[model samples]
Target: MAESEAILAAWDAYSDRHSDADGWPLDEVAYGWRMVQRDSETWRAFLPVRPGARQLLATAAFQLQHLSAGDIAPHWPSHLRDLNQALDRLEELRRGHAEVREARRTSGPVSQEKFIDSVAERNEEAWGYLDTWAAKGHVLLDVHAAAYKAPVRWVPTPAPTTVPARRAGRHV
Candidate 1:
């Protein structure tokens, strides 16, 4: 199986093991995968973390920490442990991803330098996962930004008008 597939499966099983009595068992890996599968447009720059998703990850991570040594399978809990660490840094990655995506939405395709700068302003550990995602074909970056500098055009918005301007430039 592919590494990401294994990661996803381990996360699924890990999350499934921990759902509480008061509520339904949430499969957090599924949630994360669903979010990742969305179109780029759905990702707004600096989009706030989804509360439900965050809670699911936190709960699963908490449970994973208490695993017995026998439960520590190199392909499973160990995988979840790594995923938990990756999930821990997701906020930073999400922010950077959103920033670049939003900039692209508003200005045009995002530049690599701007994306790099945005990533650099945040924690490297966080950016590392994002870069991994990009490398794994889950995301992409502008090659121009990787090469020569370029300008991004602003998206046109309706011009706001003052009362005077609205009234044919006549004073009240």
Candidate 2:
């Protein structure tokens, strides 16, 4: 099956299992994963430009941190640590890109080519970190869905229907 189909199937299974209890936010998780997949494909086509790539990286970091702060962290400390490491590397790449941009701005048009050349390496490094983070996130989501469980609340019983007595046993 295609990757997206597999992901959808897994989500369906997880939702079925956790139908009674609150768990991960499905919309947020799905959106984040979609962004990661799109970014990876774009990276393969060509180096992602700075603004869009930064946004994607920031989104990934936020999602990772959200997962880490939730019930998943305790159950998967190693995966959480890997995500944190990836975040650090991504941040470093961001700083490097910013510095290059600043240098280019101050150097005027003459050095534009030089700056672009320098940024290519940093962009590639950013893509590498992002790819690793995406893979780790997939594993984290799968494991969390498989193992994590929130507090179970029993389904409330329905109230009894109040039926009026037949009118003095009169026939309908």
Local accuracy of candidate 1 as per-residue lDDT tens digits, 14-52: 556655555355666664444343312122221343344
**lDDT agreement of model 2 with the native:** 0.54
The number of clashing residue pairs in each candidate reads 2, 0
Clashing pairs for predicted structure model 1, backbone only: 45-98, 112-145
lDDT of 2 by residue, 1-172 (tens): 1343344455457565544456554466664455444544434433333335445435544454544344444535565567567657867776887887886778666476676556556655665555555455555455445344444336799987987779886999
TM-score of 2: 0.42
Model 1 whole-model lDDT (C-alpha atoms):
0.45
Q: State the C-alpha lDDT per candidate.
A: 0.45, 0.54
**Residue 77 C-alpha lDDT in model 1:** 40
Q: What TM-score would each prediction reach against the true structure? A: 0.27, 0.42
- Model 2 bad stretches (over 4 Å): 1-75, 143-149, 152-172
Instruction: Compute the lDDT of residue 137 as modeled in candidate 1.
Output: 22
